[model samples]
Target: MPSSVEPARPAGHHTPGPPGPAPATPPSGDGSRVIPFGRRTTRTGRGRRTPQPPQPERVVAPDSPQQRLALDVEAWFLAHQATLTDEAAAHVYRTTLDFLQLMLTSSHAEERLSPDEYQHLTGMMQVLRDAPDTL
Candidate 1:
């Protein structure tokens, strides 16, 4: 009895013509496709793209020294908002703001803080001033 098997093609050999059509249905004039999810269209597709609710804008403090200090402290806090959860971080923010308030009121603001405190406060001030540029 003869074997009912065909010889295999050698490696790198292929019987080729134009490749088969795409697995996906092509889009129509209205941009619809016959997908399993249903008749999907670019404009009329039923998906989870609901409109987002608008958030209320934060009111900025005024330009006076005290207000400016508070805004700087707040901006620094917001930038590092994740740090707020730590008790030590919260204490640092509170202490820095309090000292900043006192220092801003003095005629010699620079003299009021130790060198390290003054440098930290200046860094926070820079953060607030540069916020618009960064964002």
Candidate 2:
């Protein structure tokens, strides 16, 4: 309402609110909570966090290079997903992507994975990235 950039809303209709992030714009890249510019963190009349707590740092062991890489790539992809061309997007499956996203973003995504095991997941992502017809 106080914003000079956003046009005034209709008298009766509610002002447009952020339902979620826009395409290519993720809420946060480091797993920290981030509200978009000019968007309310909560809905009007809805229960919102009072005195938000400090987000724990997303730190992983220095030894797990593969795990670290996985997180970095997942975060990057999430932040850039909206920019992917339709042809590139078509090659990926939502379900598979979601699964990889979750697995990579998990606190200890590489807990049980060996170097070889990590390669398997990355290989799967690569295969899925541009899955071409075998026929």
Each model's lDDT comes to: 0.55, 0.53
lDDT of 1 by residue, 2-49 (tens): 232867557556434236775475556644332335545677657668
Model 1 earns a TM-score of: 0.22
Report the CA-based lDDT of candidate 1 relative to the real structure: 0.55
Give the distance in Å from residue 71's predicted Cα in candidate 2 to where it truly belongs.
29
Model 1, runs deviating above 4 Å: 1-110
Task: Assess the local accuracy of residue 28 in candidate 1 as a C-alpha lDDT between 0 and 100.
Answer: 60
Q: After superposition, how far is residue 46 of candidate 2 from its true place, in Å?
A: 60
Any residue pairs clashing in model 2, and if so which? none
Ten residues in a row with the worst lDDT in model 1? 126-135
Model 2 stretches with alpha carbons more than 4 Å out: 1-95, 98-110, 132-135
TM-score of 2: 0.24
Estimate TM-scores for all models: 0.22, 0.24
